[model samples]
Target: MEAESGKHIQKAEGTKLEQSSFEPSALSFQLKIGFDGKRAANNLTGLGNYSRSLIEHLAHQFPENQYLVYSPKVKSSKQIDAFFKLKNIELKLPLNGRFLWRSLNILKDLSRDEVKIYHGLSHEIPFAIQHTRIKSVVTIHDLIFLRFPRYFKYIDRKLYLLKSRYACKHANKIIAISEKTKADIVEFYKIDPDKIQVIYQSCDDSFKMPFNKETLSRIRATYKLPEKYILNVGTIEERKNLKLIVQALKEVNEAYKLVVIGKQTKYFKTVEKEIEKLGLKNRILFLKNIPFSDLPGIYQMASVFAYPSFYEGFGIPIIEALYSNVPVVAATGSCLEEAGGPDSLYVSPTDSTGLAAAINQILSSEQQQARMKKKGLEFVQKFNNPLVTQQLMDSYKALLNTANY
Candidate 1:
């Protein structure tokens, strides 16, 4: 949130090399950026990952600007200890400690702090602050509610549409995670294409580093993880299509089990019913609520990672699997290709036979697995921390340069 006398900054429309770099040490301008920290505080899901990673990188890579992260209540500061170590970033708690200050009172605080840029990490921006001088940016991760209406309750779907549409209409610029998301924004909300910028997200750096044998063995013993399994990590919901993977596993004649790591929803009952009907109890395993620190080991130990999600803004787990040196077999549709890369196997979303064939093909051959692993590692290099951090900083700089303060 650098305060400069400018009329307006337009959307960024250049490659990484084309943009001018802002020197972090010299800090030519004074920018104070405020972010909606609600998701970053209590959640460990995708939203939380996006918020925490972006904020941490901004503070680390661009130390010149000040950052304010506003949240209702922070579960524990220790979870994000690396972020707190940075002097330029501060987390502000709600005054009452009992209410979500975002809708009610966060605006007054932002105005008082004289924040120049307010970013809504989730699909929301404060309505009270929209007309003010503060320039706004909103990140819309996905339009899942709109894409799969039956998955969401009526009230939740309506609210998501309302908030997402309002934010898109009012924000100075929108950050879409992928081209698919950008297209959906334009189609669903009728927003101008020029107003949106697509920025791909990277998984945490921890995923890239190799885990030691002792730690892996401890986690496996603690969780009772199988030696060989097809890993799938995502929420257990209809749109995620976890049941399809289970169905496909039945046809594959291998000792490798299907290990799922995600929170279970009511829709999990549907999957459970299928599992019981098939009596494939020993073949399918669900590991819910595993510690985030242990996820890399889980991914590394898997025989092959399978993601049959119907759609996603960008699939972080696929990238995580790539970094872990695990071969991937994902669904064909949507942005999974961007995450899985060309070397990995792809099958139709609904075709169990196709999925089974792909899984079997990878498991049967050691040379194929090695080649895919090598290619996946090479392909995922673009999503490394330095590249993604630069892209994000460029977007922030572009927004600030084009806005009137």
Candidate 2:
């Protein structure tokens, strides 16, 4: 790959001019970014996925910017095919190292390399090194436990709020993943709106419908997915409201099977038991730990993509479903309203009957389904990575101008 001329890269003559250039060679300023690698090593859930994807994008977009991804385990097999694009971005995985050591010693390491900024991709900044002179920015994905504490178990909920409070109080700038989350931060933490920047997360471009017949057939056989199944992607949890979806699927026409693609948790035994009682053994299929590459085929082959989660900072799979031109049925709560709009077939998350009726209506009406395919394609356009990535780059420019970072 030819190195993009730092001067001409931004001046390329295309609508998606921003994406054409990926140059890490002319790095003018160094950035040392720390992550919750200890937490990341355990389970890569919402915040972990958010941290990994955005940092990958940043590393690609500003190749000239020295990118150091500081993780707890310095060495391990956490290779992301998504990051195959950012070959130059250094991964400083300090595996088996104490979290305290990385949190405290990271800045000194950055200083030795003369790195200008230290960004914490997670909410918890280094509490031990807050007063350091290095420029700092923290990404607060969401204050979920702060707003919906009851959704979390006691001990996990307690620790999150306390750590978030400290990070918000001290970090030079805060990156809020959604506008709804920024509002929560402003209200709960009482931070200035100016201090909090809304950086919408982008759907990984790999989640597009693939054309390879051999690959599609292999994935289909492996998952045992029907050619015409309703798809739901995301972890099985209470907030995901999988129980209602399972219940609603029972009422849908017997021809349309329900296929769920994600990991099931112990708390979601309620959903698992409901599936058993309903005798949906053949009607419903659950494929956990589905590979990222295979997901686009899952979305493309679905009769309709349903996500009835009660809350979200931003719904990535909704956008993924839309891009695949799969008709979407998203919940009418929280960020879904902002994320899906008319592109999705919407119903209140509160009413299971309402959800069931909507599903029946979509499944029954071919005309309505046709309209949704077009609407979803239109809705997904705004979420195209080049646009969102440029917005993120603008945020980086703003942070640079802030004089604080």
Candidate 3:
């Protein structure tokens, strides 16, 4: 009796499949989404943060979509670039060794395996994969290489410009983190404006809530933070405009120290030398690679968070600072205004005096700080988890509509 019932169910399912116009995939799924996992589970920066958040969001939101993470392969065409190394790389990711192996060789396998959508989490797309069945989508974080080439090495800038130009030209769709970035891509690459979509980046979930006083004290002790210090946290690269931030600190009262949280690259020494020249050695502290968990407390302890970077795709740190209720004095131009919205005190990135004056105003006026704190929280509220995740899903759906997934 059981054998007869099983045969009946099988016969019915076969009939349905025969009648239906769409057939189930030869594999378990219809679509495959690929991410450039070059930085995943290793040292987490803005790109890593963006990658990790989006991966988790995608996995949770659309469980049916089969996702493939494309990382670098170890053996072929590998040049160990020291500039990419961070101390935390070994702490978590076991797949770090296999990365170069995948990027060089296994990318070709995507076509063999029938991947439908390939998304470059960073600006780069594997040049070898263009002939494959996979449709490419590239996210252009910024055109800073074109806009501020002087801040980068000549060769590095040229390489980024070339690669990004190719990616923009070839990809099926382009994702821009801000409107300013989309505009820059259009002007520089001369791509069709209709091909790009402006999607804002969301702050990390860890920054959403406040930190405890004990944790703040521990972070202060661990980093040896100065009493009553101001904070600036991001990469200590030249494009961050640290020279002006250091110069601006000179005009403020001696009670406040300018605390920077990021590592030093070669070009960053220019800012360090200026700090010494201005007799600010004792007043400015550089702390690199703080754990992300502790940054919220560090931000909370900050009298104000001053970020006067000349360029950005979208200022995630500004959103993080605001979420922690830290008053912000961020630069006005580019996407800083978009990220900080109306809540931040926008100073011209090149004007040290403007930055200093803005800081002084925020520091001296308690009412202004209070108002900014309130407004900052409110500003960040719109950029919460659901909205950003939903926006990205909508973009993916739109791309599918335009192209065969």
Q: Write the residue-wise lDDT of candidate 2 on 175-270 in tens digits.
A: 887788888889898998888887677676666545477877888898888867888999887888888888888778889899988877875789
Candidate 2 or 1, higher lDDT: 1
Model 3 per-residue lDDT at 162: 75
Give the candidate number with the greatest TM-score: 1
TM-score of each: 0.89, 0.85, 0.82
Please provide, for model 1 over 1-405, each residue's C-alpha lDDT reduced to its tens digit, 9 standing for 90 to 100.
Answer: 111111111122321122125443455437889999878766667788779788877777777787788876655434554444455667776555435478757777788778989999999998866678888899999998898888789999999998899999999889998888999999999999999998888888889999999999998999889878999999998888988998998888668898899989988999999888888898888999887889999999999999999988889999999999999999987889988889999999999999999999999999999999999999999888878889877887887788744
Ten-residue region with minimum lDDT total, candidate 1 = 1-10
Residue 27's C-alpha lDDT in candidate 3? 33
lDDT, candidate 3, 188-297, per-residue tens: 99999999988788876778877777887898899898879899998888778889989999999789999998878876879879988999999988887676668788
- Cand. 1 TM to true fold: 0.89
Which sections of candidate 1 miss by over 4 Å?
1-29, 80-82, 95-100
Off by over 4 Å in 2: 1-48, 81-87, 93-99, 128-130
| Residue 16, candidate 1: alpha-carbon lDDT | 18
Per-candidate clashes, comma-separated: 7, 10, 9
